[model samples]
Target: MSTTPLVLLHAFPLDSRMWDGLTEPLARRARLITPDQRGLGTATLPDTGAAPSLDDAADDVLAQLDQLGIDRAVVGGCSMGGYLTMAVLRKAPERVSGLVFIDTKAGADTDEARANRLTTAERVMREGHQGWLAENMMSVLVGPTTHAERPEVLARVRELVDAQPPAGIAWALRAMADRPDSTATLRAADVPALVIMGAEDQLTPMAEATAMVDALPNATLATVQGAGHLSPLEDPESVAKTVLDWLP
Candidate 1:
């Protein structure tokens, strides 16, 4: 093993391309792998009949690492990808050296949130991924601050998201709706970890990340001002720098 310790698995509503900004700097020394979750990017979608759950999503990420022949590596993720990283840490603790949780949390959706997620998932199913891609996804991803100030970043986020499969988006949203609460699991993981969030995040919000930080014994929390849910995209340079600083 070369001992390069990290692989970046990005969140939903986007693909591995979301990690582009952070890759060059991270690639210098860390063995980094940025993979699109199942059905999101170039990766083949799951059999429609057999959708993925949080556990299955975690398995998919581990499977990606296995295919790359990385025996042990740090795992980092954002948004839904961040939630899945928690699943990976739970299901394959031995394989994870550390974790980078960006704009994500360890809790499951509340009942109302779950209902809203289902509504979104159903919309993706009915309206088609491409349609949803153009409409809803564009608005909520980057906070209004980023939307007005940094059009380039917002454009990049849309460009990357447009490449995804509709079924993948629907499946992921449904899976997230039913994900198990992993606060207990996260609290138990005694590894070095980074829990980061955007100070002005509207979706996951900074308070959620704070609760997550409170539970993880070895985790450090970092906040980016004026950014939204997608910290890696909204402020990639700063996000990447924080990640590098956190790593051994």
Candidate 2:
């Protein structure tokens, strides 16, 4: 196995801690660096008084690599993290050796979705993170199997969501709302790619995963049984095994 570093970006309204389960197993295979994107987790971005774009978030990750003295590495993400990964690929394709897109899509937000995101961002700013998580995020974060069989997983997800800063969450919502379609990027990518989605993922279902796999120049899809949007947490062992087997 190659010892190339791997950078895993977390989902929206969550932080680097989301990847905790895969850390040890993945670390044994390759160096792993998980960064809390701006305003999320421990990363504190100075208040710019404007909604940051996905390009800005992508630059932040590249800057992180520069700070760590890493020239290039495989870049991957889940959900919102996947958006950032595509942005990074657009901005600095030379720095990415491989691509791992988990439970994410290649299209831009629909107009209605963009409007919804703006509304959610405003609500978060006014009502705060906890309320937003309860009213808007909780239902879509997991799948039926997880809710029925894994209360602990749901609880952990809640804890992670609750811990995020409201400002960061709002910023992320706006960033996602404005992100561009990445289908062309995926089509052009020549590096090895792996796409993972939960069998029960509602947000980005198996069909969407299949579409992404078909777009990539070289890619494979792995479905995690009994998992949801947050597959890495809902079924960490399976996700880890798939990643370990797929990593270049």
Candidate 3:
């Protein structure tokens, strides 16, 4: 088996700590690098009054890899982190040995979605992540099963969301709003790809996940039952098992 490193990127607004559940198990199998994107967690970057592009975020990952002396690795991400993963594949395909996309879409935001993201960016900047989390945390982050059966998971999600920096949240919103469609990038990638989704992920539903799976030349889809957008948090065991089974 190849001993290439594995880089797992976290979802939006949350930092690398969001992957805590899967970290130990996955780390036993391979070297794992989970860096916080700019302005999130302890990773700080100067805010230039404009949102950084996905390419910029990808560059951050590349720079981190260089600093760690890793030449190539399996790269994967969840949500906004998935966007950065695709951007990395586009910008530096040589650095990627495999790909994993979790609960994310290959398409760019629609006009309405982009507008809403911008509006959200403004709101997060003005009122902070608390207001945004208050409105979206319970309803949008996890699935119905989590809502009905997993109060502990919900609490953990709350903690991760609460720890986010407002500036980082706003920056992520704007970056996602302006991100380009990555369907073409997905189509062109020739490496092994694993697409994992929560069965109840309303944000990126089954149809979207199916589309992503169909687009890739070599890809497999794993749907985690009883989970939602934050599947890693909602059902970390299943996510880790699926990922570990698929990894080389």
Candidate 4:
């Protein structure tokens, strides 16, 4: 197997810790780097007064690669991480050797969705807490199978969500709300791609996964059984197996 580094970006309101389960297995195959995006985990939000931009987030990822002396890598992400993956592809396509998109779509948010995200960001900032996200997002984040059989996973997810700083969460919401449609980018991508989705992922279901597969000239879809939007966390074994099989 090739040893090209694999950079796995995390989901929204989550950190690099989300990939903990896949780390060891994947590391045996290739070098793995899971950096916490700005304002999310241990990373501090820059004091810059500028607005949130996925492009800037992408730049941050690329800059990290620069610091590490990695010239190229396979970039992949889940949900919000997927958005950032596309941003990186757009901002610096030459740096990416492959693409892995999990439980995410290539289209921009609908107007209503954008507005809702903006509203939520405002509410979280105003309230100075992210309890609402922790309370409301659990059901949507994991699938019914997880909810019924994996209560521990749900509790772990809640802890991860609750631990995130409100500022980071709010900034991520705004950045995601403004992300552009990446269908064209995928269509033009020259690298191999793997699009994975949870079997029961309601947020970006089979249709979304298939759409990405169809768009990529060289891509395949892997649906994780008994998982949802956060499939990596809900069913890491299956996800890791699929990814390991796909990796070169």
User: What TM-score do all the candidates reach, one by one?
Assistant: 0.93, 0.97, 0.96, 0.98
Worst 10 residues of 3 by lDDT: 129-138
**Native-referenced Cα lDDT, model 3:** 0.88
Tens-digit per-residue lDDT, 77-135, candidate 3:
99988999999999999999899999999999999999988898888888787745644
What are the lDDT scores of the predictions, listed in order? 0.82, 0.90, 0.88, 0.92
Quality of model 1 by C-alpha lDDT: 0.82
Give the alpha carbon lDDT tens digit for every residue of 1-248 in model 1. 23476878787788888888888888876888888887788877767576558788788878878898888888889998888888898898999888889988888899998998888788777877664564676676777789889999877877777777778888888889878888998888888889888887778867788888888889899988878888788888999899888886
Cα-based lDDT at residue 195, candidate 1: 88
Q: How do these models rank on TM-score, best leading?
A: 4, 2, 3, 1
| Candidate number with the higher lDDT (2 or 4) | 4
Question: Candidate 1 vs candidate 4: which has greater TM-score?
Answer: 4
State which candidate has the highest TM-score. 4
Single out the weakest 10-residue window by summed lDDT for candidate 4.
Answer: 128-137
Clash-forming residue pairs, model 1? 4-31
- In the range 1-248, model 4's lDDT, one tens digit per residue, is 66879999999879999999999899989889999998999988887898899999998999999999999999999999999999999999999999999999999999999999999999889886556787788878999999999999988888898899999989999999999999999998999999999999988879989999999999989989899999999999999999999996
TM-score of 3: 0.96
After superposition on all C-alphas, the RMSD of every candidate to the true structure, in Å, is: 1.9, 1.2, 1.4, 0.9
Stronger candidate by lDDT (1 vs 3): 3
